[model samples]
Target: MALSEIPMGQIRTYGQIGKAISCQSAQAVGTAVSKNPWLILIPCHRVLPSSGHLGNYAVGEDVKCFLLRLEGLRFDNP
Candidate 1:
């Protein structure tokens, strides 16, 4: 349900999800995200690193970026 709210051209950090759910730890959220089997269906690619890095993806970072770009989301890493 949380994934359903991620609009196109937007993203949410693992920390944000964790914080919303009262987990208080992005690493734990990342771990749960890693277990997500739906991938693009659930839009896990919309989850970015808290530090603004692209980070890894189950389908690889290149594929992840491609999907985000396809959805018109920008990659603004520092």
Candidate 2:
């Protein structure tokens, strides 16, 4: 999965993942990501919206923010 391909400390937008898999809908990608059962194993926390906002996760947004921050990613607007 493209989610697995996202390097640690890096992030990808939903549209980017969709494009990587040849899917045109970012919402579809978001849906697929939300359904990920592997959680951190797949690094779904690394996926965000095109607006650079932290989108929904199977886990809470706080946990997602925590994971991303732990990975050395900082957010000016977070």
Candidate 3:
């Protein structure tokens, strides 16, 4: 699956995944990602805001931050 292809320690934007599936908006991709039933398997944690800021996550922004930190990802202020 597309999510599985994303490597660990790497990050992707919603728009990038949207383009991969031919979706027009990153919002659309965010919707699909929010509904992903297999969170761990899909690795939605790897996705971040296009502005390089961590956005709201289904599990909460705190959790998102935790996951990103666990992966050693650093983000600059937007």
Ranking by TM-score: 2, 1, 3
Candidate 3 overall Cα lDDT vs. reference?
A: 0.81
- Name the lDDT of candidate 2: 0.88
Give a tens-digit lDDT track for model 1, residues 10-66: 899988888778898899889888888998778888988878888778878888889
RMSD in angstroms, candidate 3?
Answer: 1.7
Candidate 1 residue-wise lDDT at 63: 87
Candidate 2, poorest ten consecutive residues by summed lDDT:
69-78
How close to the true structure is residue 76 of candidate 2, measured as C-alpha lDDT? 42
| Higher-scoring candidate on TM-score, 1 or 2 | 2
At residue 53, give the lDDT of candidate 1: 89
Give me the displacement of residue 5 in model 2, in angstroms.
0.5
Model 2 lDDT per residue over 4-63, tens place: 999999999999999999999999999988889999788999989988778787778888
Please name the candidate that would achieve the greatest TM-score relative to the true structure. Answer: 2
- Stretches of candidate 1 exceeding 4 Å from the true structure: 76-78
Which stretches of candidate 3 lie above 4 Å from their native place? 76-78
Residue 8, candidate 3: alpha-carbon lDDT: 87
